[model samples]
Target: MGDFRRSRLSSTPVVGRVVEWKKTHGWIEPECTIDHPEMAKHQGHIFVHGEDLVPKWRNLVAGAMVEFFLYYDGQGLGAEECTSRKVLRVTLPWKHAKEMFGESGEKLADFEQQTHVTIRAYQWCQPDGNNSDLPFLLFEIWGRPQAVVESIGALAARREQDGNAAEDTLCVNLLLPESRMWKVDLMQLQHYCSLEVSSSITITDPMPCRTLTIQAPLPHFRSSLHALIAQAACVGNLW
Candidate 1:
């Protein structure tokens, strides 16, 4: 009985290069420009704040390509919707982590050695159909509801495809980018999963899907296809 609607507000991901890096309340808050259609509507700038870095990440400079997650409840959303929400946490590139920690395959399971966080892959964080590269970062600022996330979350839970599931449980994968991968970074990600979670989420429960491609039924995400469709009135009744 996982509520896809409820989960939509939890947290979202983004990918981009650093536009600005600030020391906010002694923490690093970086603003990036995402190419999502919603971003295009906003003129393409989003703010992502991070409380603590893994010490090694302290040197992350501006212009560094990175991907991270943002949590925005949007109690007081305004025209500057991107930074309207609070940034609970942020993550850097996974390759950086792997490079720094050295092939931490089984080492990730032992919490005593963990000093970082991990977030899995999700549609919001991936690149759009039009873009050749993966989207840089993700943020959930208040606007209209995330029509696209809601649709995919609901549909994915209904069936299986690409060897993914066909159950009511929506099968959204969370750790593809490993940005603050709280799914596996147990000590740091305690807020995201069950208390008993200890290891990395390798395979996720999937829903039966009708297609399998780099970007299948859920396509043209960066353009915010569903959002565009909703805007155009093709699927007006869906909302």
Candidate 2:
């Protein structure tokens, strides 16, 4: 009888929306009662604690969708191991040399320079053609200020004229549990950022490896680009 009761009360993963969230605790409203009818007693409310959320820094925003399991914690129904279904907007910090002509290449006085990117959790097929359960973050750099656009264009033009084709690529080194390098075309970057330019550059396929060194035309630019990728990884919980 005890086992039966437990089975009846506990539920499989269910979809719900966060109705209210405080820093410590919150309430979620289950979308349906197909599996757990007891939810009706609490008016479709499921208790969720901040500790139960995955990627802990990301607190559930009100009205955001979530997937969780229902279990009776003696006192009442609660959620456990909750996963949020919201896209994350992350800011990638970038700092360049204050004076490019300087020998030491001093960094800009303001360290707060940044651009915004959107990241969403996705399931991607591995080279082995198997769909891994691990969450892959798909991020796009969508925010390009006029200054940034001009800077990138100048760097690309300078690198292109040098005749080293590799220097014209933007290298994104993902420092996750498994490190990987993704090389994107400088021209593609301009295009994606809505810069008016024509180019015959083709996108490079993602190169997965245990370790790789990130390269760029200039040292300061490489450092800034590295920081930007690191920020994205941190926000996506891939670090």
Clashing pairs in 2: none
Each prediction's TM-score versus the true structure: 0.21, 0.35
Off by over 4 Å in 1: 1-18, 22-151, 154-157, 160-169, 176-239
Q: Compared with the true structure, what per-residue lDDT tens digits does model 2 show for residues 30-133?
A: 76564555566667698888766775535666766676777775566777778764222221212122132122323211211332211222234668999644
The Cα local distance difference test for each model comes to 0.28, 0.43
lDDT of 1 by residue, 108-149 (tens): 333212312222222222234452243222211111234334
Highest-lDDT candidate: 2
Which 10-residue window of candidate 1 scores lowest in summed lDDT? Answer: 77-86
State in Å the error of residue 191, model 1: 14
Tell me the deviation in Å of residue 61 in model 2.
1.6
